[model samples]
Target: MTVFISPLIPVVIAVAALVIAVIKDYRIGTLIVVILAFTNVGGQQIFEAYHVFLLIIMLTAFSLTLAVLRGSVAVQGIKEFNILLAIFGTWSFLSGVIAIDHELWFGMIEYMIRAFLVLYLVYNSFSKGEEIFRLFKIIVFSMFLSSIISFFAMIGSLSLSVETLLSLFSTRFAGTIVDPNFYAMTIAGIIPLAFVLITEEKRIALKAFWIISVFFLMLTIVFSQSRTGIIAISIIFIYSLYNLMRKKRVEILFFIIPIIVILILIPPAFWFRMSVFVESLSSGARADTSVVHRLLLLRSALDVFLKNPIFGVGLGNFEAIAGRYTIDPMVCHNTYLEIASNLGLLGTVPFVLLLYRGFMLPKHSMQNPNVRELSWAVRTGLLGMYVAILFLSVPFKLDLWILLSIAAILGRKISSEKSP
Candidate 1:
């Protein structure tokens, strides 16, 4: 019952809203999307494996049936890239079918369930521009709230139940995330929303809260000392500000000035942690040395790739091959390498193309001012995600997988528009 306000509910509700809105008022359906965006990232889910997957299955079946009955096979905004990723994802899915290791194949296909949902959201997103704006507001508010908690947790202020469990032994800014880097990566994506919120949200109370969230979230990133999250934040900040400028949003100086001022007043300790990570990435080379241990992980993965290069070793079998290397098996931290290592050229190409086209479509759609606001906001957020994942990790979380599925739905829209 207490979980009713849980952050993750908004995302699924948004998906459901799209279905309902598609039948009647897309604007109403669009409200669900907004709620999910705001409530997107918080804590990990309690029930794992089957329960979550079952929900995804139900959503997919329902969405597909609704779309087909409507003759469009999608809500109003369904784009071509959505279908392409689904199709490409299927190839990846098929590779799982022929995968050498039983467990890994099952896991790879399991992950794609979220991909399907993202496509659903995107299909619905294209329904109306006002809804997109509304969703962006929700995304901003959620980020603001989460950032504040994370900041306090990092600085020795507000303590959360999740933090107590994760750092019961150690004091780090893992926050709502299971890993410090993952936490950092997720927050990094929030930077764009924060900037956008400060621009669009004129109410003084909202502005005060938004400003506070930014300061603290930045503080968490600093102490957690995640290089990727920090870097991604910088990139997103610059990119978003550029977008605002392009749109000529310079009139909001009264609001923007105070927020900018607050961001600059961060404690020096934050920079100290960041400096150390930079040192580690460059001449420090300690993290690299530790990464060297992954050589063993990579070699073992390569052995599997050699045997299954056409389809490769399959989606989830990276760990199975680890038996030849060491007793305790693990993930290859470099997701791109792991995918290539497991799935081979044959399996990896289609998936990459789907991402490539999905990312590109928003840029093509940005010429229209209304379309630009909605499309670029997501794209800018994605740009942060792209940057963060490269340094932090790949798409492993339920939230991330679900977001990808929404991207696919958007991809379908682009594909349809570009099609003959």
Candidate 2:
């Protein structure tokens, strides 16, 4: 059926693109990776079994490794964070082996492959500041493209009548990205990038372009109607306001006015959705149905962690085994709880350390003013993503890895410049 095979379209296109890019020139791999990052947000859904982004990462790694070994490309020093990542990935795979349920083991293995490749390839890809700048261009362009798609999709869906309006608000704008929340998160993640670009660029035309881009990106987030997305935008804006107040007070208007416009233009349904959060808090614990389900899911994850405290119920086994604990089956919505449930304390420690190290490097990169400023944006974006994962199980999403790649590359660049 067309419905069943629709997902294959992205897979085939990605495969062809990867093949051509590799055959034409190895440097094209970076471009393809950028495409994969953008596509993964909402584009990968075309293929039900499509792990093309992972494939692209693996291929790029293999090609880059061959180039290095053959002396065609200079070898960059491996960072400690990458080694820690490898160790954690190995542990994750081992944990999967002892999993109580094997139905989803393959999917877990696939994710481990993608995560490892992202850590290794991103760290190795950029050896110079210029390369990082090029990557940044790709990121900015991708965000722009994604935001445009989201805005248009929302417009196309809008219709007359309260019935139509209600349905529109009920449905989130997916755009090229399949899931509304993920699309919104992607747009939200790019908010800081738009802000940084708006500040850093000197040209009046360019600044105006970024301003328009930022407005629509904000609109896309609003249209997606995701609480996580809204919170992510709030986080970015707060970070922006704090940074701007300290450094560039006059320019804060570029950010503040658009944020106010977005809040004012938001539909009644979105406001109601947001009110649920406030209402849930006021009503006491587990009062909201959605919040109650999440709490129950968290409890179920904790139960799994307690039962399998060492190796875990196993990777991908949480949903299968969690049914015993909860009336309805659910994946671990919280990333921390999911990691704890899947890998237990033994694996969770290294995994947490990997994330910590990833974060701290960016924090330390503040030595370079440019790196510091950009890192602030990247850090806030990653934080937003982490917040998002608290509501959705997206451990292997390519956009998160791309953000990590950017953080790792910036941190490494800073470290490399520290000379003997």
Candidate 3:
């Protein structure tokens, strides 16, 4: 006889684990949620119709409420970053209110709210340098896990051969994120964090783990075949090389060797794609259909922005109305352009301010010895992410928000240290 098990059993166990984690330590609970947010494992269809990730977040939030009531967690008031976030969120809501597709707008709005909550929780939960470092490690760990999963997915048959490798390079690796470009962008953002961990780690085993993680992550990006991801990786590599040479020259070998191997192993098709991408930038005649399509989308976004200079089409309305301007209906693949065309200057201004604040946090914290490495790591990671987003319409990415929160918390911690 076959025993029938209810699907709710797993859900109940997961809920219990999340509650226990939060009760023991709310920061740990936040980290668990961050891992889910980054890896997107909890969002998968593990429970059929139920949203396991949302349930975890709700339970964690409830546990946090209890912690606050017991005075274990202290709530802080609004600051500059919070003010900018609130303004941007409010403007987005207004834009959504007038959106052409209310359902799409509401969906995006809900995602934005969730991202903001993550930022708020992370910014408030951790205060110490060590705690912040753990947060970074957790993010790097998430990426490492994603890279491994992607590697296996790329090597479907687990057969090691030039033909198999070359065939795999022709295909993009989306991993758990389900979008090749976004997955590669996410990996690019985490690469610098992994590198920093390698440099700061005292134990040889941990350092080796980070170095291996970086290797897998680089491989994942290469398999993704995203030009934007490659560009971001180049920027990160140059920055990391310079820093390693200055601080830990010996560790440079660990960093450079993997890159050299990757370069040598990358198929000609990969190089050809890069060449085409570069040539297309200078001459539209040489551009592939994908490049031409993006160019058209860019023009459409500009046209929409011009028409609605103050508050463009409306949140999530660009996708609804894009077919009228372009041959195909799609969201503008450019984040800044998407924002400008969707919400106009009213929304873009505050959004840009929030990003500026995130960037400045690391700049201000550079002097603090306690968080100097972390500051550099966060800044470099953000630099890569910012460059990647120029070609991606991902305004509600939870990982980006979490990184910003880390920067904010580090900045505040540095400020507190400097104060008498």
lDDT of 2 at 286: 33
Better of 2 and 3 by TM-score: 3
Residue-level lDDT of model 1, residues 1-420, one tens digit each, is 364577878988986675565455433333443333334332334345345444534554465556568776445533544465655566677776666687767765655654455445445544344434455556556655665675555556536677664553245566645577777776666555565555556699977776666666666665565656767777876776665678687634533553475357534655655565566556665445434445556666666677667676667767667777767677665565567666687656765665566566566556554345446556666677777765432644444443444444333333323211
The parts of candidate 1 lying over 4 Å away from their true place are 1-45, 48-79, 97-100, 146-170, 202-204, 238-290, 294-309, 323-328, 396-420
* Most accurate candidate by lDDT: 3
**Candidate 3: tens digits of C-alpha lDDT, residues 1-420:** 999999999999987776787877767778877888777676433454126676666666777788899987777643768778777788888886678899878877877877887887787788777777777788888878776866776687657888776678777887777778888788887777887788788899998888888888888787888888988888877887898798867867866887898788677887988787777777865678787788788889999999999987778788888999777889888888998999999988888888878878877777877678788888888888888888999987877888888888777655545211
User: Taking the tens digit of each residue's C-alpha lDDT, what string does model 2 give over 1-420?
Assistant: 354668889999987876767744555675677666664642446554365555666677777877877877775644756566666677777876687777676677776676666655666667555566556557767777865776666667677678876675567776577788887777766677667777777789977888887887787777778888888778777877887899867778987899889979889988877787777757754366776677788888988898878777677778877788677887867877887888888777877776666667677676776566577767877877777777777777777777777787777666545210
> Which of the two candidates, 1 or 2, achieves a greater TM-score against the reference?
2
Model 3 segments more than 4 A misplaced: 1-11, 42-50, 158-162, 242-255, 415-420
Prediction 2 global C-alpha lDDT: 0.72
Which residue segments of model 2 deviate by more than 4 Å? 1-20, 41-44, 48-51, 74-78, 157-167, 281-288, 415-420
Worst 10 residues of 1 by lDDT: 411-420
lDDT of candidates 1 onward, in order: 0.56, 0.72, 0.79
TM-scores of the candidates in the order shown: 0.70, 0.86, 0.90
> How accurate locally is residue 45 in candidate 1, as Cα lDDT from 0 to 100?
42
